[model samples]
Target: MDLYARFDLPPPPPPTVFSRDHTDGRARMPNFASVDEVSKFVDASRLWRHSRGANDFLRFGTAYLLVISLLVAAGILHKIYKRSFWVFRIVPRGHSNILIPNVHNSWALFITPYLWILAASSIAHIIGDARNEPVVNISLWISIMWSPTLFAVWYQAWGLIAARLGDGSASFEELPGHSLTKSMPSWLINAVFLLLPVVPSVAASLVGAIGNAHLEHARYGWYDWHTKYDGTPELTRDMVLDAQNIFHESIRGAYHVCISQAIWGMMCFLFGTAHSFATSSLIFSIGDHLQAKRRAVLAQKPRIIPQALPTHAPVIDRSLPQISQSDFSFKWRTADEAISKPLPSITCDSMSTDNQHSRIETRMYTFGQRMHDQHISFFPAIKSSSTIVRIEASKAERVLNFFIIQSVSIMLGTVALISDSLYMALHSYAAAEANNYESAFITGYIAVVIITLLAGTGSFISSTHTTFEASFTALLYARRFDPGSSDISSSGGERTDFLNME
Candidate 1:
């Protein structure tokens, strides 16, 4: 007590320099513990936030879906208009005798659908961006066009089923006339295919919702508009206290809206499908009408009548006196001479020519009979026999062909997905390093363009290959099933009339 009184000062206060426990009147800034932590927080608010990535993904995914859908739609339409119907016939090289128009329809098949898809997708994209709509909203609109595209896919599947049931023939008699609803397998039509077209839209919507949720959860403090001016006089404590009451009110609200987006997508998809179904049915009816008309015309052609004429006749020679150097004409034999002269017996060369003509006529009739027997008079390239064994063999061949093409598609899809991911990563890294985000995005866009071009090229090649393969397979089937038919032989060598559309 005596020593404390002598010192006359309290024990030295504890140092406030590195201690947060001090109760000092001086203001202290908030501590982040380390520079790295501050750097991480800043990055979260700017470059490394989950919301930013999610938004980018949404934009890219929507565009990609639109592009792919365009390609698929064009491909299906091309198959339906050109390959399935043979609306245009191939002409022989250097032989312009055919009266048919020479206009090429291939570009129409490619460009028309491209323009349609482009217009629809661009409109959706612009509207979504202008309105600041959610990803699911934009996707739902884009899916409207997707449903009609699937119609062609379903139509192709129907064609396949028709071919199988018809024993690899697509003739109106063998294929159903009512609609695709009748032609598709009951299980596939009622259950699988109908659901498949909706799956992509549903999956995308779900993914977008999940991504949005993740983005909201990982948001940083600095990103909050309230905390943005925390140190300034304009942000008062009382106001911040009041804002906390309503800040969390709408956090869960955005996610709940996804349900509505999903419903809208479903409705649009159904509408498009119904529209396509009706349109396709009408087209099928028209096709049936045209085929029936063609049959009637063929049946109405006049039959050629053969007359038995003497193969050889005595040569007529009448020498006339020359009236003038420039005006001299030969005289016909007199009626008496003509009546008196007996027709010479048919010579061996003339007889041989007659026999050859008879053989040709007999061969034509026999070929027609064989075509009827093969059940492919209407569909020339499709060859089917009365025996079930032959049909089964053809089915196996068709399966093999489809399997190979499907495998190629699967492989290409996988490669494209991986490539897209890798390119996106590259874009992100390059953009961050250069700190020129706009340029980076533009480069990414260029990459997408490249990818789309490559995809289009691949699709074109695959389609060409498939068309050729189908035609060739049909031809081979025809030859194997009807080897004796001279019609197929002559046309097969001279032209591509035997299309294996099956």
Candidate 2:
């Protein structure tokens, strides 16, 4: 139910050829020697249950301060609770990859950086509150933490990208997913994949946060960090003026040029943004495409019909010598034996004692005849199979990514423009009423950002959602499923277990 769990899955793997994903991994796909062997993995009905989906109780409870109450309860009940009081899980959906090592560890260990960032951010916020400078503290923290956080997010949830690399089954199908051109080498794609995150990570580290710090120090309380380190950058006068000038230009005179332009670097998202793509939405789209895919998989699932040998079992105790004495015989023949004569099976009715070919031999001849009649042949045709490619991120992919960057740039610029317009409106009203300007620009732009963030998050998620063990012991528990109640429903028939996953 929490907003963050989807992004909390494991990091995406380095780019690999399509083949290595299924066949080359250390884990072995189940091998079936017979129908019975394959049946071992099949379920009587789908084993997936709705409650088995991703549940980030840590994030959910912490979001509402419910964790505080949970902590108190856990302190009291620590003796009786031998099992975990809570669980957070992300089930592999459709054919999405998970547990590649084929083992689940403590979720805390599995996603270490997630907790690291959480602690870092919480401490930053606490420091901000302590300093009575929430704005400055947050601005600096976001800047310093931006790069690591980006890595952490991917480290946690990148595997979702793997799902888009191929169709759920072996063969590649691109209608609902992304596949870079075959000409693109996997090394190139790996390079691109590696470089994409670095773009924003470096950008955020360079300007987004540092710019805020420079602007705060220059225009507000001037501090020279040369004599002693104050933990802030040792920005030169030129750097301060430059950061201030560029930032003010971004503000678009909404702050009355000289004084009002400082709202804690509110427009600081200029050069740095996450390396997400419109492709990601298309990749993570939770619309009809995912539902359609699920339906297709279920519809295509192989139906197993139990087959049995004849109820009247065959008695086959006939000795080879006894059979040899009769018209029928079992003998190891060398090439010399067949050099001058047709084999018994090929000699008309002599292949069988009943003056006919055996059942298998007859079936083969009949199949050949049917094939000839139908003009059907498979020897010359290729069946569906997997292809391995190390792909480079395409020019098309780069173009799309750049496209999103421009779009975000325009969106932020538009937000600035609209904020300025509202400020003008407020300025006019204040002049007419002979009252205060009421800080309309700051309040107005922030409201716009909140509304935009809400809308974007909603649309984005109509798209994505990943797991582990150093197990997080839940301080409290919430049960949404009850076996005593026969209110069970299948996420099958329509969708799949992936959908049933929380």
Candidate 3:
């Protein structure tokens, strides 16, 4: 108590003076009236804080959803178009030639869907501001939407390279009809398909990184609009507060959008990769089967050759005449004059022997039929029976194997898509419950990725199957007909002779 009383000095205070000689160049300090003045001054200069608004987040979410839905619709339409029964047509050329009519170009099939998705998404983005809830964050939505198209582009480019490297055509129509084994170029096609899905995922990661950088800048004071003060007039406190709220809301919306976009991008990449892998595997299996067919054909080495033979008949003489030596000489001279110097030395036995030997040689060397003893014989029946069995077995195996593999690939792709959708649904539910809108937006993006990946996988599988079928048909046709031979001759000669011979 005594110390407090001495230090407090309530009633009066004394001032001390210093001599200039003793004080070494010291300056006097200013005194504050009270601690309250310092506190009030500090409080006056400090920035005000406000709650983040929800309007901008709502706008972004609305836009994102609207755009994505349109994209989904477009994708569905594309699927319908591809699966339509009217897409294929058979065009007949004369009595012998048949062609499958192709309505749209290959590039059209690949590009049109992407274009539709892009257009629809763009429109949705433009109209988003008016909707109650925006589709998604605009920036994120755009990034996710662009992935499939970008993947397609990459796929196409890689496909071209692979085709060139394999010395094959780049068209989807060029794929093997049966198995990868049968089509020498099928592996290359599968490889290209497999490679395509990676591009979109990588692009997504890059975009995410960029978005994060922007987010960081925003987090700091770098882009803070509230900090800018012009000489014309300072913003009122309310205006400043409002601006800050708007900025925060915008940031939140953007962050949610980016998160959603990134998740979508990742899903797409994964789906695409999985699909490509599955399709490629199927293609390889088909190729292998086809190769087996080729090998079987090669091993058989069946040959066909025309048979030339002469008909034989017994000779019979009913009448004979006897002549004297003088008569004989007169008859010979008369015969020589009548038959234009007479036929030179008629040797029936010699001619007969030569013909028999030639026929024997032909029969011995030929692979198919042999006609001997005035009867069609053993070799023809054996050859024909073997050929029929081989053709039937080959065709059945190829078609069955290809169809099974393709079906499996399709099923797998579909299941993957479904799984992705389910996961998204769960994530969405969690986000909603937690009031974590950003997580919910990302969850919704899974649908886009799944759809795109499924589309690509389905297309590849279908195309591969088509290719196998075409190849098998081509092979069958080649085996059945001679490439060097004509079905119809140019000359107006009767086809009866050809028909009879066949």
Error of 3 at 63 (Å): 21
Q: Candidate 3's residue-wise lDDT over 1-502, tens digit each? A: 2312323322211111211122321111112233333222222211111113333433444454445445545543654565421221222122321112121122224434554554455444334434422333234334444555444434433332222211111223454453552354534534545555555556664665554443334333322433343231532433333333333333333443345454554564555455455335434543443444344333322221222233352343322222221121100010011112212223333232222111101011111111222112221111111111112334435554654554454445445544554454344323322223344443344344445444544434434453443333222112111212332336633121101100
Superposed Cα deviation of residue 35, candidate 3 (Å):
35
Q: Per-residue lDDT for 1-502 in model 2, tens only? A: 2111322322222222211233232112122333332222221001111111111322332242333223333432441253222222222323332221101111112223332433344443344334433223323433443344334233322322332222122123443333543345545544554444576555544554554444354323222221122333442333333322322322222122212222212222321122133223422332223233233323322322223335465543322211111123111111111122212222222222211110001011111122232111111111221121111213223323443443344345435534543454345222212111124323433343343333333322221110001100000000111112211135312112221110
Measured by TM-score, how close is model 1 to the native structure? 0.31
Q: What's the count of clashing pairs in each model shown?
A: 1, 14, 31
Candidate 2 ranges with C-alpha deviation above 4 Å: 1-138, 144-158, 168-181, 216-308, 311-502
Ten-residue region with minimum lDDT total, candidate 3: 328-337
Candidate 1 local lDDT, residue 78: 58
Return the top candidate by lDDT: 3
Candidate 3 displacement at residue 469 in angstroms: 10
What's the TM-score of each model vs. the native? Answer: 0.31, 0.30, 0.28
